[model samples]
Target: MHVVQAALVAFGVVFVAELGDKTQLLALGFGARHSLRRVALGLTLGYGAAGLIAVVVGAVLGAAFPQRPIEIVGGLVFIAFAVLSLRRDDDEEDDDHSGLSVGRLAMSSVIASIALTILIAEMGDKTQIATAALAARSNPVGTWIGATLGEVSSGMVGAAAGSVVGDRIPPSVLRWLSAALFALFGVSMLLGFP
Candidate 1:
């Protein structure tokens, strides 16, 4: 029961945290010009590193902080992110694959850049906070594992349907749905819902 609950929180938080945002767009834009497989690999590895770091941090913080504060902070942050998402405008150019390849710098550069961005962005982000709270609910190992699994697999969830076409996943209803989920989760956490 605890594991199931942890998984739900993990999946819900990570899956919603990554939506029709800049990073996802960058990955898709890279996929548009390069081999989707390499792009996918880069994204997966980059996100894996970020998720691992987040889980570790969360585990540590959970051991140190009270649950109520963490939950409130996480919920507020998530709501802010959702509102920000509602106000965002996408108009960036694709520079993620300007000089990479299916063999050399492609995978390395992309992975490095993505991991860096996610690390910086996730430093104190709501998703990380929520993940920490979720981590707090379980043992450290389980928390880390659950968070890693949830956050890492989120990319695939966002890009699943269109990924079948050997192209990047389009920001379809998936993005909206993920955003909605996040907002809802945030409110639930704020309200201390079980």
Candidate 2:
């Protein structure tokens, strides 16, 4: 039951954090410009790397700070990100693409870009704190597996759709939904939702 709850929470948080994110746009743009499968590869690998880093950071911080303190910080930070999401982006996320090639370059460059973008974007985010909280409530393996699966699953869907749709979705609606989801998570964490 706890595991189930953790998985659900993990999926919800990561999925919400991903919508309207830079990495999501990157995935979409890369998908449209390149092979969807290849783009998925790059994006998945990138997101995996970032998630690993986040897990490690979450573990360390979870140890250093009490759960509530870290959660408070994370919730506050995510609120800021949510607020930013509510506004028009100064530069649309899909504005540029770095030159990418095949073989090693494809794996290295594409994956690296995705990983870096997501990592920077998610630093001190509610997603990370949720991962930590889930870890506390569930077994380590369960938490890790749930986190990995949740993020990768959502990422694949986003990458596939982003590649084909590529900004086809209504921008205003996406932003509003993203902001609402993020803010909901913040409030839930701070207030300890029932």
Candidate 3:
């Protein structure tokens, strides 16, 4: 089915986008202090909620606009984001969460803290934007499911191997890969490829 295919494509794109991203890094840091299960659950729930909102927004936009124009705009947005990612400095990528004081909140309950943290962190994130864009281009439900799962998967991996993976792999490589994938999809959309 087309839905299945769309889900798979969304999954791959979101998975690649999440790797070495700030969300994953946050998961890794949280996992170090809190229980892995808690971190995973928090991330899953947070991302799920975020994905749902993104899908709804995208679906609304998709319904309002013609397919070709929507696709063209989505493609352009992806391309623009790709360029932004390519130009982003490594140090500048670190999200400054110092003022938030998640640590104090974590003292009460790790799960709640993590959930809140992820919900806040994920707001306006690149992965969220990508999910919204994917929804606009494909099946909204499928895109939401795939993107949420992709985020959860990345969270799990980061929880388990954050230190190792983050240290071993350079962030630049992930940025480049994400940029390339976004560019490819953007070009495909512009070319009117299904």
lDDT tens digits by residue: candidate 3, 41-116: 7888888887887777744644566767755765676577557547644322222432455643433355665665
lDDT digits (tens) for residues 1-194 of candidate 2 = 46667666666777776666544654554454445555666656655555565555676755666666645654675476568667663333333332423354544554554455455444455665667666656654556556666666666666677555645656676666666655665665567441
Residue range with the least summed lDDT across 10 consecutive positions in model 1: 86-95
Give candidate 2's TM-score. 0.53
Compose the digit string of candidate 1's lDDT tens values, residues 17-136: 666643454344334433455456666666666556665675565567777775687577657655643432232122354454443453565455445534434544555666667665
Order of quality (TM-score):
3, 2, 1
TM-scores for all candidates: the values are: 0.49, 0.53, 0.57
List residue ranges in candidate 3 displaced over 4 A.
58-108, 162-194
Model 1: residue 76 alpha-carbon error in angstroms: 25
Q: Which residue runs of candidate 1 sit more than 4 Å off their true CA positions?
A: 1-5, 58-102, 157-194
Which is the winner by TM-score between candidate 1 and candidate 3?
Answer: 3
Clashing pairs in 3: none
Report the number of clashing residue pairs per model: 0, 1, 0
